[model samples]
Target: MNTGKVTLLSAGPGDLDLLTIRAAKALAAADVVLLDDLANPGIVSLAPRARVIRVGKRGGCKSTPQAFIQRLMQRYASKGLHVVRVKGGDALLFGRAGEELAALRRAAIPVEIVNGISSGFAAAASLGVSLTHREHCQGVTFITAHLQDHGEPDWAALAATGTTLAIYMGMSRIESICAGLMTTLPASTAAAVVQWAGTADERRLVTTLGRLADEANAAGLGSPAVILVGNAIGEAEAFTVRGFGRAASEGLAHAA
Candidate 1:
């Protein structure tokens, strides 16, 4: 018998090869694939028999609204179609999967989750950096600059324990975050932004807290990116990462 359900699937960061075998199977069996911009299209192509729906919500671009996306999932599932909502990274993180889960539940549709690799891990791997460096950061926090006019986040808290902070979708708010961190993190504190992370055209800006914002802006590092702030970022400046700020920490060590 056909099932009416929506699977909130994670397509991983960018590399299609990172997809899990089960996720690959789901994609193959999906009757409709609702994919976000961050989720690679090549991965979805595996589900050639399914309807491909590009619901990429790029910042400042024409996007299918969140409500609309949820409604589509529910509507499609009601028709006994297997809907696979492909999200980049993990669906439970900043992907706003809760809302869709609620919508599906209210409609009494079956739902499942297929986890995927996250951008934080992918970006860190591409740069050979660790979010939990034993000598520096002990924990990691994943957040997003998800506001239009929201004030700066609490730098004192973010800087207090030296935990790694991985930000997604914060290109526009980079200035505010950097400025806040500079107050306590020092100008030399390692900081970086990875653009097109885990992809062939990936780029990394290796700079200190003070220059992180300027370098990112100057480089035009826009959406579909990740920002990491912490001493662990020192690894990103390594030549192997093809970084831009080779000497970004020259004077900050003395300041710290």
Candidate 2:
């Protein structure tokens, strides 16, 4: 029996519309889909013929083990099934695609990758700001706050880069992240947080580094959010302090 292939599909940032054409096609032909916690559950509509498996991986919450997910993919593909491992945001950006790719290769299963919009870009879009503006930032850097070894990245070095910093999975350590970067960057440096970017339930907080933690906490922004810090953030349309609690609309404060 011939072994099947695996397609690591990017579901984009919780928005079904952000899903790429190629990704939709892959889903339409899927045999088994391993969905992530962040991906829109509505995406399963495209894969009507496939068996949808909720292999949710969420930070700071109960999640399906990476090894187990890999084993499931290997098992399904070994039986000649077209396995689609759906991930939120760009699959290559901190979605553990490397491990899945390596595992599939070891098992001799052909793999295909379909890219989609990352949350960093979506966050910037939500704020109507360019992460790498020629006048503001020389470039942009995408980094994860959480590391496999549980070590934090060099915040001072990153701050010195003079580029827009789009930090992922850092909401839980917003205070620490702000403190580390404040060591190099100014306390008044522009900072923003976009939660559930590109989705209807999206919320945003725009403030300075010194007040990011406090403002974000007061607004009740939580995990699965993108933390953006840098001078480029000052270029955002509404660079002034803003909050998004359970109910918030235009003009900063939470709605009464």
Candidate 3:
């Protein structure tokens, strides 16, 4: 019997237009598609003839177990059915692609990865700021607020690096994260949060490291938002029309 193949695809920050050609092709040819909560529902239309299954994993909500998702992929591939595992943002970045890849390999299954735009980039674009500016930051760091082992990340060391930080799954722990970074980074370091990035409903707030948590809470920002911190962010008044003190309703417009 011929073994089916598996494709790990990135859905790209909740926007259908952000999907890559390769990702779209894979979706169109999939025999079965397993989609995450972050993926846009419109993507399902790409694989009209395939079995589309919702296997989303969201924080503080009922999520599909990782083990079960892996097993389902393995089973489907063994049955000679092409499986597409769709995740939001880049599949390899905080999407748990490692576990699924390892499991498929152990099961002797064929698997391929198709990359897509990450939320960090989208967030940066929405704020009209570059994560890496030669005068400000030399590099960028992508970190998750949710720890797999439930242990705290070394925020002080990360802050010392002086790289721009793009924090994911951080809304719930915003206060602590801001406090931790304050230990090493200055209280005046620029910070911003982009919620629902790359879409029509996107919202953004710019503030200092010391006020990020408070401003985010005041704006009612929650999970599924990307938190950016670094001097590279500068000030909101410089880019957004709403000036520095208030949250902007739309984040993509550039200031002339």
Candidate 4:
């Protein structure tokens, strides 16, 4: 009997357009799809004949167990069903793809990974800036503010790297994250937040490290957001015009 395979397909933030052609083709051929919380719901249409299962894993909310999701994938694939695990953003980027991959491998199930744009990149695009601006930073660093131990990351050490910081699952502890980074980064260091990046409801806020938390709070920004820090964020076209000044900050509270 021919064994089925599992395809770990990245959904690319919340934009259907950002979904890669290969991902779409995989979806079309899928017999079962495990959809993630952050992926666009419209993608279900791509797999019209496939059974879609929502195994959402949003922070601060009830989530489907990882073990159960893995078991479902294994069970289906073992029955010669083409299982597609659809994840938001790049599956390899904090999407628990590593654990799923390991589980599939141990089960001897054939697997393939289809890469897609991450939310960090979408956030950068929303701000119209390059994360690795030659004059500003050497490269980019993607880190999650949420750790398995619920402990904090070495913000000071990360700051010392001099790379653009793209922080995920950070809005809930924006203040502390900023405070940790402030140990090495100056208060005037540019910071920005992009909520629901790559979607129609996307909102952007540009400010300094000192004001990021407060500004984000004032703007009613919450989770499902990406926090960006470094000189590169200052290069955004709207940075100077929408940030810095008290008047502009006040306006941004309502506008952004």
Candidate 5:
């Protein structure tokens, strides 16, 4: 008997509109779905016939263990039931997808990955700014603030050299990230926090490297945010004519 396969789908943050048709179909056809908190539960509602399980891992909060989630995915797929692992944002970006992929590969379970709109790009889009402005910057690099030990990101490379930095899952360590970026980035560099990008509640706080930490913290931005640092983000003010980044200038945008 052939066991069912597992689809590792990127749910693209909290917005259901960002989901791809392939992912939507997988969810609808799934017999079992493992969902993370970042994903809108309404997306799972499409797969009403499937058993839904929550295995979310929120920062500083008690939640399901990673190992347990991996085991459950394997177990359910082994039973010949289509398993869908719905994660918020692009699963490959800071989502620990490599670990899960390895476990499934070792277990001989077929695994397919579906990419979604990443929070970094979405945040940039929401701000109506270009992360890779040819005049200000030519390269856009994505990096996590830390692994687990709170060690610094690859500051020496991206910062020392020239590249736009789009940090993911860095809200919890905005202070640390700010300090590190200051080491190489100019103090006057433009920076911003796009909280809950791609949603109606999207909020954007544009400031400089010298005050990004204070501004983002004071605004009380929460997790699931993306921080864009570099001169490329400087264009946010001009982009707001299209209603993009209106939150910063209009005051209607609260810290989401």
Candidate 6:
């Protein structure tokens, strides 16, 4: 019997056009496709004849068990079928690709990874700001608010790093995260939340670290949003403010 292979493909922030050529090829050739809830539904169309399985795992919602997903992949690949595991954003970043990789390896299956643009980058792009602006931040850090142990993250250490922070799955704990960061980062530190980044329903809120939770709540931003914190955010916020001011001034001038 011929051995099968598995490809972990990143769907690239819910936009099919953002998919890499290699990722598209893998999907087109797949015999089985394991889809995630956050992934763009259009990706499934690429796997015309493949058996598409929805194994969505969303926070605070009923989700497919990780073990079951791993077993399904292993079972399909062992039967000489090309399996494509479609994940939103970059598959390796907080997507549990490590667990699936381990399972496939233990089953003696061939596995390949296709990288895609992470939501962190997408969120930043949507705001027209660079997370690593030379005068603002030297680097960027991507961390998840949700940990497997449900324990707290080292907010103090993270704040002390002075790197731009792109926090995922943090909407539910925005208040706690903000409070924790305040211990190290200044209350005036700039922050922003970009919800549904890269999609048509995108929304954003810009405010100070001290007011991020309240501002986000007032704006009704929730999960599937990226929380950005650091001086880098100031650049975008400033631009937005200037644009708003200019528009208001033009309206008054026209009225006069």
- Candidate that scores best on lDDT: 4
Question: Compared with the true structure, what per-residue lDDT tens digits does model 1 show for residues 126-154?
Answer: 66778898888689988777754666567
lDDT of each: 0.81, 0.87, 0.87, 0.89, 0.84, 0.86
Q: How many pairs of residues collide in model 5?
A: 1
**TM-score of every candidate relative to the true structure:** 0.89, 0.93, 0.93, 0.94, 0.93, 0.93
Off by over 4 Å in 2: 1-3, 238-256
- Cα deviation at 64, candidate 2, in Å, is 1.2
lDDT of 4 at 165: 98
By lDDT: ranked, best first? 4, 3, 2, 6, 5, 1
Question: What value of lDDT does candidate 1 attain over all alpha carbons?
Answer: 0.81
Worst 10 residues of 3 by lDDT: 247-256
Give per-residue CA lDDT, model 3, range 1-256, as digits (tens): 8769999999999778899999989999999999998999899998877899999898879999999999999989999999999999999999899999999999999999999999999988777778998789899999998998977789999999999999998999999999999999999999888888887667787788998899889878887899999988874447666454233534333222
User: Total clashes, candidate 1?
Assistant: 0
Q: State candidate 3's TM-score.
A: 0.93
Clashes of each: 0, 0, 0, 0, 1, 0
Lowest summed lDDT over 10 consecutive residues: which window, candidate 5? Answer: 243-252
lDDT of candidate 3 at residue 75, scale 0 to 100: 88
Q: Name the candidate, 3 or 6, with the larger lDDT value.
A: 3
lDDT of 3: 0.87
- Give the per-residue Cα lDDT of candidate 5 at 101: 97
Preferred candidate (lDDT higher): 1 or 5 = 5
Cα deviation of 7 in candidate 4 (Å)?
0.4
Which pairs clash (backbone N, Cα, C closer than 3 Å) in model 2? none
lDDT of 2 by residue, 115-157 (tens): 9999999988777779997888799999999999999999999
Report the C-alpha lDDT of model 5 over 139-202, residue by residue, as the tens digit.
9999887567967676657787678888887888888788877888878998888878887678
- What's the residue-level lDDT of 221 in candidate 2? 90
